[model samples]
Target: MMYAAGLAGVAVTMLLILIRVLLGPTVYDRILGINLFGTKTVLVIALLAFLGGRTDYLDLALTYALINFIGTVAVLKFMQYGDLGWAGDVEDDSDV
Candidate 1:
């Protein structure tokens, strides 16, 4: 009963986040919305696992959370550097 209410609340919040991701005024705003959505997804998975008495789902949720974190970091890095494999500034000495 209470779990169902919590799930409903999370679903509403996720819907709002999805809207922000789609209509965000800036790229950063969209990125933040995506991150928040991922967090809510993890919460939903956790709640479902608890409600179903399936602890194995918690492991899947953890894995998804990790992937979500890594993906967000990768996207942010690409946005900042324009490339995922960007290396820091390197001094050129071969001309000497």
Candidate 2:
């Protein structure tokens, strides 16, 4: 019962963070909310696995963490400059 309550609380917190992400005043704030949501998700997954005696599920959490980090970096770079180029190394592929 306690474990369920904890996971439910984490889910509620995640929902609040989602709202913040939607109504953020700035790109950075939204990114921060997104990062927080990802972190909470990882923690909840780990907690559930531990409660269930399923340690192997941790590998899934690790994969999600790596993907989340990559996505956050990409989003930060795009928000800073509105482009996905190689950090100010834009290339023109037209020969006129």
Best by the lDDT measure: 1
TM-score per candidate: 0.86, 0.75
Indicate the residue-level lDDT of 74 in model 2: 90
Worst 10 residues of 2 by lDDT: 86-95
Candidate 2 has which clashing residue pairs, if any?
none
**Candidate 2: clashing residue pairs, number:** 0
Tens-digit lDDT track for model 2 on 1-96?
A: 676888899999999999999999898899899999999989788778887889898987787788889889899888777888755645855657
Per-model lDDT: 0.89, 0.86
lDDT of 1 by residue, 39-94 (tens): 99999998888888897999988988899998889988898788989874678556
* Model 1: residue 10 alpha-carbon error in angstroms: 0.5
Q: What lDDT does model 1 reach?
A: 0.89
Model 1 scores a TM of 0.86
